[model samples]
Target: MDTQLIRRRMARYVEMVDAGDIDGILGLYADDAVIEDPVGTPALVGLQAIARFYREGLGRTEASAQLTGPVRVAGNGCAAMPMRVDLMWNGEPCSLHVIDVMEFDDKGRIRSMKAYWGELNVERRPE
Candidate 1:
């Protein structure tokens, strides 16, 4: 995929998340996509697993994400975006700083997504 296209897609991902558009978010992935959020957990394979993961997480929470930096494109068909996500988790307001690296398939769909964040990157928001 072209770097510009990937950048646009990454931006769209943030827009969809902010809009709480799950279907639109999923539309950016390939049928057999794989995701490992925060990168060490078990991978969520295929669209169904991915859907369930998002539905149970972001879907169940009041969540919004913003890109903190420009999308960085790699020589390979991959791009990464820096983001800050604020959401209601377990009835508490919190935020996470994340960097998501996505590999795109030939069709320009995300074939793999690996999020880089850890507990240190998470912060509790004061009410």
Candidate 2:
């Protein structure tokens, strides 16, 4: 796994999220990719499921992700990205600090993504 490639891809993923490009974000995943956002919910599997997840999530509000730290890449085809997600929900602004672990396939598509975040990490944004 090329470290630079992984870093570049992950960085692009962040950009897509920030831009609210659901299709662009979904394009980053493999056909059989799985995402366990927050690590406790039922995993979203495959492109269709992943698309639904992003749609419902983004539909809730205007959302964006800003990197809070450097993207960490390993020798393996995996990387960890730290960021803060800002969004409006129920007419209230909210923010969540998150770290997502992404595993890539040999083809450079994300095979798995697991987000690490909890209620404690969430905050109400000031109006």
User: Which residue pairs come into collision in candidate 1?
Assistant: none
* Superposed Cα deviation of residue 42, candidate 2 (Å): 0.9
> How well does each candidate superpose onto the true structure, as a TM-score?
0.96, 0.96
Residue pairs whose backbone atoms clash in candidate 2: none
Stretches of candidate 1 off by over 4 Å are none
lDDT of 1 by residue, 35-80 (tens): 9996999999999999998898889888899999999999788999
Whole-model lDDT, candidate 2? 0.91
Would you list the C-alpha lDDT of every candidate in the order shown?
0.92, 0.91
lDDT of 1 at 10: 90
Error of 1 at 118 (Å): 1.1
RMSD of 2: 1.0
**Candidate 2 runs further than 4 Å off:** none
User: Model 2, range 1-127, lDDT digits (tens) per residue?
Assistant: 8899999899998889999999899889999999999899999899999999999987557888888999999988989999898987557899989999999999899999999999898899998
